[model samples]
Target: MLQSVPDDGLLPVDTAQFRTAMGRFASGITIVTARVDDIDHAMTASAFTSVSLTPPLVLVCVEKIARFHDAILRAGKWGVSVLGASAVDVSTHLARRGRPLLGQLDSYPHYRGRTGAALLSDALAWLECRTWATYDGGDHTIVVGEVVALDVARSSEPALLYHEGSYRTVQETTDER
Candidate 1:
């Protein structure tokens, strides 16, 4: 799914500076999940994005060797659960690579989504997606999907964010557009 661009194609006038500046954009953390070998797999990701609205497309980047990468690819679907402030513990649980096997029934309080991926109940929003395509991006594989289901939260609680390699928070929302 690589869209080839000739060398003359320019990304930005200041790629390096923009990257450093974008690090200041603290977005919500999310857990992307899929099943592999009849076993559940999940990963903590901060690189989730809204791709489009017409078809409800979304994108999530998985590192080439991420434990959940191959599974998501194979499952041909995924669930994106946006962590709410109260769900930090669930986020921490899914993030542990050496974690003991947690049965689906008792795993982070979840319910099966439209695509059958576990959607955390505490998430501010959860979207079930059908795998659309996968493409290489250096050390990562970018996957795009069309949302098939949606769940939203009533409370707009503060969401956990990864910044400077650690979890942080925002106290106030900016009114500026």
Candidate 2:
């Protein structure tokens, strides 16, 4: 015999269903970077958002299992490089684990932000931030940072977009005419 429990909303949702539902929302791509122990670490993430305007706060979610999770926690400073449409290769390289940051940095043109985090050169935009707070986010941690510095490197370039498990670029519609 088997028993069924009431729907209390405490149980986790199916991963496939959750992913399919969430993928409908398109977002910009970013590589979150940090300098720890004089070394740079980075992760490709789409789970970033603006948290506040008055304090110029932004948030990025990182899985607790990611190697940079602890690095960010320890360093307390990070940079966000908004990838240009031409930055697909950069995003793919940084998204993988166990890669040396120095080698990648050498391969690509980059610069250090005010917070000492590495920012990819020619990015659509970049932001340097310091950790302001953290919150629980299930399997991930929500890192909120106060923006200290930022710049738009190339506003004319198309911004990279990610949706439905693939990379996309923004298109200009005729309605804008």
TM-score of each model, paired residue for residue: 0.79, 0.90
lDDT of 1 by residue, 75-132 (tens): 9988999987777677777777766655732746887787889888888899999998
Residue 127, candidate 1: Cα error in Å is: 0.1
Best by lDDT: 2
Model 2 per-residue lDDT tens digits across residues 61-80: 99999998998999999999
User: In candidate 1, residue 92 scores what lDDT?
Assistant: 76
Candidate 2 regions exceeding 4 Å error are 1-11
Query: What C-alpha lDDT do the candidate models reach, one value each?
Result: 0.81, 0.90
Candidate 1 wrongly placed segments (more than 4 Å): 1-23, 100-107, 173-177
